[model samples]
Target: MEVDYNKISRQYDDVRSADLKLISLFSEEVEMNENTRILDFGCGTGNYADKLQKVTGAKIYGVDPSDGMREKAKAKNSNVVFYKGNDKNIPFDNNFFHFIYMTDVIHHIPEIRVMFNELKRVLKSNGKICIATQSHTQIEKRFYVKYFPTTAKVDKERYPDIEKIISSGKEENLEYINSVTYCDNQLVKVGKEFVNLVERKGYSMFHLIEDSEYKQGLRRLKSEIKEKELELETAGGTLVWFKKK
Candidate 1:
């Protein structure tokens, strides 16, 4: 699927990054020492790059296909190199990176196998690749099904199982050291703003939802929020981190 990079890029940080809980987990798992050469695959708007530079002293290169995202990242860090293209053909030599990362972008890619091999190719031996994506747990899928049914189907079909990723890495001669999964269990209210974003992004990705269904889902979500005196943040998805052996 060709993603509407323009639309998604405009609101990427506001609608998505604010509540991401996996940042800390990824930080813990991927230890970056000084002089670390990093490639942040699908580094939309450099959200993680901003933090990685501050915390790790790693020389970071961000790659994304979104023009809007590349512009924003360049504005933020004038010296940072932000490339525009799909991740599978990263414009770098083999064994050029000490670490690589792709956060919440695994499901968005149409070619997962190619990306896996490409990531392994560029990484130095004993380097690490940390990927944080949605979990394949019943509870995780169930929540999306109830709140955003149309989007749930898209995610279910696209997100590769963490185990599959680990195995693929091994096949490409990248040793898998460990995989850790986390789920944040908490109920937060869902408001109209979030619902609108859900509808826009979800509808664009999956055309299975009708206007009536979208309205009904919003109505139900709002009603539940009011009754529970809550905000629309629910249990967060799990983050799976794998290290290269």
Candidate 2:
């Protein structure tokens, strides 16, 4: 199912926020300074872009296709500039950014090779691109998947494999840097909070599954929550890095 960002923009931030650990990882991988220019590719709601600018004092720019998402991001009262664009056609000039990062965004892009080529066009020589995504194993082990079996299948089909991402970057002359997997030790949501998130279809995967299946899954999830007072556990994913050749 296709997610309508404009429709969901109102409540997007309520369920999602900047993952500080992921931001820290990106900061460590890329050398950001006051003079550095950074682009948040497929930046939804500008959360990461705003946080990154404050953390590194860098010139941050955000590009996303959703007007609603861009509007929300622009309202943050930060120096980060928001633009309406996508991975296929970035509006910036050649060699414009020192670093580009996309958090959990690669799966939505249809053409990985084309994205790498466009990223290369905007990235300065040796500039880095960091992609934070779930590997197949991670997706299979998502906490929600136990209740919603279809989520794992949906995500597995939608998300590109890690090896495929690396090869696409290589084909576009983007050298592979390193890949790291992280498992957050923090509890993201618990009991009723998690149930409410699923009820509202806060996650895109919830929209993809069959309505009957979703309803059944929700019932099962609620039962588990009620019986066990379940606490939604950690979030884990892999961060793939590359550099423009």
Candidate 3:
């Protein structure tokens, strides 16, 4: 969906802050220390950047095209540098970053090829670029796909393919080192929290479809859940990680 991120920056972090598992996985894969320079690409509110900085004592940098998002991130932590940059042009010197991590924001980027080149340009030799994103293979079987059918179409068209990432990695001399799948749905009370989340329209995917469709799907979900009157589980996504060859 075409988005005006400045309008959503305030509420964005509230919903996104649900999972820290991705951050843990990143710390495990990317070697971190006091002197390490880390980049939180497409950082929404700099929440992860702030968390990472504290966890590893690394000099952290976050980049996003949204001024509102950047400002929010900067407000969270002044120590971490926040930049306004895009997919084709990341305003950084060559071999600048020891590690880079982007999650859930890959599909939103408009320039995949140029961004891949930019990644290669700024990333240090042997530095890992960890990408946590949705894959086409997972979409057909996603639990929530039934709720909002159009989401599958939107996601399939936008999400970068694994093979393509590997191909780009090969062309960029980056390695297709490792990858994994994650079931990211948070368990919540079906009657309350679950419905509230849907109402908040926290996910950008919710904004992709028409309001009528969104309500239709939500109504169905709520009806089904009120029958159970218990907890609900949602969202399934996959993650892929690559390294500099």
- Top candidate when judged by lDDT against the true structure: 2
Give per-residue CA lDDT, model 3, range 1-245, as digits (tens). Answer: 57678988878776667257777878777779888988888887888889888878999999899999898888888889999997887889999999988877888877676777898888898888988787787765556678889888987888877777667667767787877877646664556565666787877778788888899989988888778766546455666777776
Q: Estimate each model's TM-score.
A: 0.83, 0.94, 0.90
1 or 2, greater by lDDT = 2
lDDT of 1 by residue, 1-245 (tens): 45676666676665555233455665676677667799888888887887777667778999998899888777777646898767578888889998787877887777666887888778887788887776666335445467557666565677777777777667766666666655555565555655556645533443445657667776787677656544333545555444555
Error of 3 at 179 (Å): 1.5
TM-score of 2: 0.94
Candidates sorted by lDDT, best first: 2, 3, 1
Give the clashing pairs for model 3: none
* Most accurate candidate by TM-score: 2
What digit string (tens of lDDT, one per residue) describes model 2 on residues 111-175?
99999999999999989999999888888878888788989999999899899899998888789
The local lDDT score (0 to 100) that residue 144 gets in candidate 1 is 44
Q: Alpha-carbon error at 79 in model 3, in Å?
A: 2.2
Worst 10 residues of 3 by lDDT: 229-238
lDDT for 87 (candidate 2): 75
Measured with C-alpha atoms, the lDDT of residue 236 in candidate 2 is 85
